[model samples]
Target: SQQGEEDPQALSIQEGENATMNCSYKTSINNLQWYRQNSGRGLVHLILIRSNEREKHSGRLRVTLDTSKKSSSLLITASRAADTASYFCATDVRARVTETSGSRLTFGEGTQLTVNP
Candidate 1:
């Protein structure tokens, strides 16, 4: 079963505004990661939060996790037109005790953010 499903399929905001996105998942995970993708480009890793961590920040971005609720959120401050892009949340699920290959990652559907200048 895949985990990490994002909420709010899309969002629109003006420059300097803030953007927030949420994701929910099923099953236990080792970590959660966020990624951003510009139009016609590949995804770029933004941040990663371990299952034990509750919050993290990087530059204009803030991420929060609530393991009790199996959810996470990403907030981008002072949004710019250049910030318009799609954001996704990914989960690294813990492998079975017998499995040795490695962990598996499941990605969310993604939230499309449009920041108007």
Candidate 2:
């Protein structure tokens, strides 16, 4: 598949600890993004990093990319109970010659993250 796949479809962490997740893809991409979804809310965009960028950080969240291995990782430091949610990695792949320039993301099943108090 040309989509990104995240491992360990679930994770649990303490209120003041860290949580880490990994994603792997099969095709070249223009960019990748991480999003979070609360139990009953819309997905929230966390961060986006281009294929050329190696790393990016937002607040307590950190992301790393390795094009050579077609993989990426997300780390949340000092995770809080409020951080409990499902996380998804999305990628904008290169469109086909006959296709348009825009590329829609194919989401993984997602990781259900729970932060305990």
Candidate 3:
């Protein structure tokens, strides 16, 4: 996988606690996006931070990107039971493509977060 494993394959926390997950990739990227998937549901787009960005926040989500390290982190603040889901970090790397190739988002192994009420 172009994307390396995410830290903490699973996390269990009580409601209101923050959940943090980290993702690392092997190559330079154009941008990185975070997604969430509820049980038996499709992935939901969360936040997309660009390679030039250091950090960004949306709602209760905070994302950080370090292009020098080829790594990114997702922080879900003030978590709730409704926020329990699998979170994935996806990286778009145009550098891997050839003239006939297309850019794609490579997803890392997701982190399953369980927020107990």
Best-fitting candidate, scored by lDDT: 1
Off by over 4 Å in 3: 96-102
Please, what are the lDDT tens digits per residue for candidate 2 over residues 6-47? 887899888999999988888898888899999988999999
Candidate 3 residue lDDT tens string, 1-117? 547568889999999999999999887778889999999999999999988899999999999988898888999899999999999988876677667876688888899999999
Name the better of 1 and 3 by TM-score. Answer: 1
Candidate 2, after superposition: displacement of residue 78 in Å? 0.3
Candidates' C-alpha lDDT: 0.92, 0.88, 0.89
Instruction: Compose the digit string of candidate 1's lDDT tens values, residues 1-117.
Output: 548998889999999999999999998888899999999999999999999999999999999999999999999999999999999999986774235566668899999999999
User: Residue 115 of model 3: what lDDT?
Assistant: 99
Best of the candidates, TM-score: 1
Candidate 2 at 66: error in angstroms? 0.5
What is the lDDT for 108 in model 3?
Answer: 85
